[model samples]
Target: MKPWLVVAWKEIFESLRDRRTLLTSLIIAPLLGPVLFSGMMQFTLAKENKDHEQRVEAGVLGADHAPQLLLWLQAQGLKRVPAPATESLVTAAVRNSQPKIVLVIPADYGEQLSAGKPASVKLYVDTSDSDARRAGERLQRLLAGYAAQTAALRLMARGIDPSIIQPVVTDEIDVSTPASRAQALLGVLSYFLLLSTLVGGMYLAIDATAGERERGSLEPLLALPVSRDALVAGKLLATMVFAAASLLLTLVTFIVALRFVPLESIGMSANLGPLVALQLWLSLLPFVPLAAALLTLIASFARSFREAQSWMTGVLLIPTLPIMLAVVAGLKPTSALMAIPSLSQHFLVSRLLRDEAIPLPEMLLSVGGTLTLAALLSALVVALWRHEKLLG
Candidate 1:
């Protein structure tokens, strides 16, 4: 057998023999993604159902001035409560009471409507509160409906068609499929999948490098006639294998767990079919070597196993940043993004989840870019191993 292959086989055998390693790297890590994702989705769905079924509570100041408007709000399922005595007290009342929205009808509201003049209503809400925000949106929609009705009545009184005042009618068509619509809900899946690749081979990489040194086995292994590059290549290959396995397990576990998730309850569907799983796995394959090489390089610099583990904890957080930024900034995938390593994998997986076709050029760019990076990092790891301090 080739030296690298022999070393890889030995490492795999050793990792399998250790129950703790197998449990953490293989079983627990893979299962965690699916379990965590499903749990969160379930909780969100429950909260959404509860919110939808509950009535929105609102407070109205100067209710007598806008009796018709207040009645319209009540018809829309807003439970009216006594408003705060002063405008400045609205915020405090909303924060302390169950009312999420307050409508302040001005004292001049009835006078303005009676005189055919424009009047404004003030809406007080705690924008920092999610429930208040939702209530505010509902109130805005109701106010818009009331305004449209009043406008129509005024046009009728003037013997003019209401359509004449509104010259253009806009129609909005949503072309997003259920899978695409679910992208927002499933966006975190990319983070979890990429995280699996980082964590899967972490322990094995640390054990192969710093753990071996701490146990005094690295010096004896380096004493062998095999080239230093071959030794590093062997370890790198083993780490990649474990990482690949972890990525596959994570995908499979998540796909199975998604089957039990009631996605339709949230008006989203995750089509995690076998083909999608295969595509996701293949799309992330190039990243396996990159993750392995990066972990091995970092672990090689550590003086002890615990220190290597500590460094890896922070290193693993790197891949999650791109995903978070993409979510926060609402970033779209472009050809330029494909050149980034972890970010590229995240974009591709997200596209696959959205059931969008990836262009051939984009796929090539991502895969080629990741492999190029892995090759460069592997060379660095080999160069580092050639030094005496690395073995020490």
Candidate 2:
């Protein structure tokens, strides 16, 4: 057997024999995001269903001025309660949360309507609630609709054409694709995926390098007839496998859960297919090697397990940098866009979400460049593996 293959097989065996660590990585694979996302989607769905069922309990002050309008409110499915007489009473009801919204008609409500002037109807709603805002908007719109209908009737009664008074009707146009719609939304998927992958590899990296050294097994393994380069190569290959496994497992769970989630019914625009998800994972492969190499080097430099785990946390935080960039920059993925590290992957996934194609040549360059960096890091690790201080 080749020396590199021999060391790689040994490390792979060592990695497997630690059943506790293997189980831990496996457990983390599906648990982290699936549980969180399911709960979040459930919560959002519950909120949407709850808000839809709300009957906008409204408080009305003036009964005499618009008895017809009060009946209109009742007809619109808004449950009306009599508002308090004074401003103080309205303020009290608002503070106590007894009324979700209140409407006040001024003393001159009839006079303004008779004079063809706009009448003031104050709507005090719980601004803290977005649902309340929508409800209030609907109430205001329904009031305007009633006014328009009444205006048409009045003009027709006066032997005037209603069409002359209302000349223009507006039709809205919205131009957004599946990808652009996803762009408009913030997917918790990206954050959780990034976090899970980084943290998932943490224990594995610690065990693969620092744990081996602390247990005094790494030196003997290094003492084997195999060259240091082969030993480093083999160990790196094993670590990469574990990282990729953790990442893949996480990806599969999330993809399955996303497919099962009722996102459209809940008023969100996200489509998570197996293909798009696989692309996302593929984009992260370079990062896995980079992460493993970084963690391994850090662990190799650290004198103790305590030091290794502590230092590796900072290693775990590096992916968050790209997350911040992707968010602030709002980058759209393109062909040459892959030249950027975190941005490239982010754009690639975002583009896929946007239902855009990942350019083949760009994908090759970015993935190739990222892998090249990982290779250089491997060489650096081999050099560190030969260092007397790291081994001793």
RMSD to truth, every model: 2.8, 3.5
Highest TM-score model number: 1
Each prediction's total of clashing residue pairs, residues at least 3 apart in sequence or on different chains, is 0, 1
Q: What are the models' TM-scores?
A: 0.89, 0.83
lDDT tens digits, residues 67-137, model 1? Answer: 88888777877788777888888878878754667889999999998788887999888888887787787
User: Model 1, stretches more than 4 Å misplaced?
Assistant: 43-55, 62-66, 81-88, 95-98, 106-120, 324-334
Off by over 4 Å in 2: 45-57, 63-65, 81-85, 92-98, 126-129, 163-168, 175-186, 264-277, 334-337
Shift in Å, residue 20, candidate 2: 4.0
Worst 10 residues of 1 by lDDT: 47-56
lDDT of 1 at 56: 66
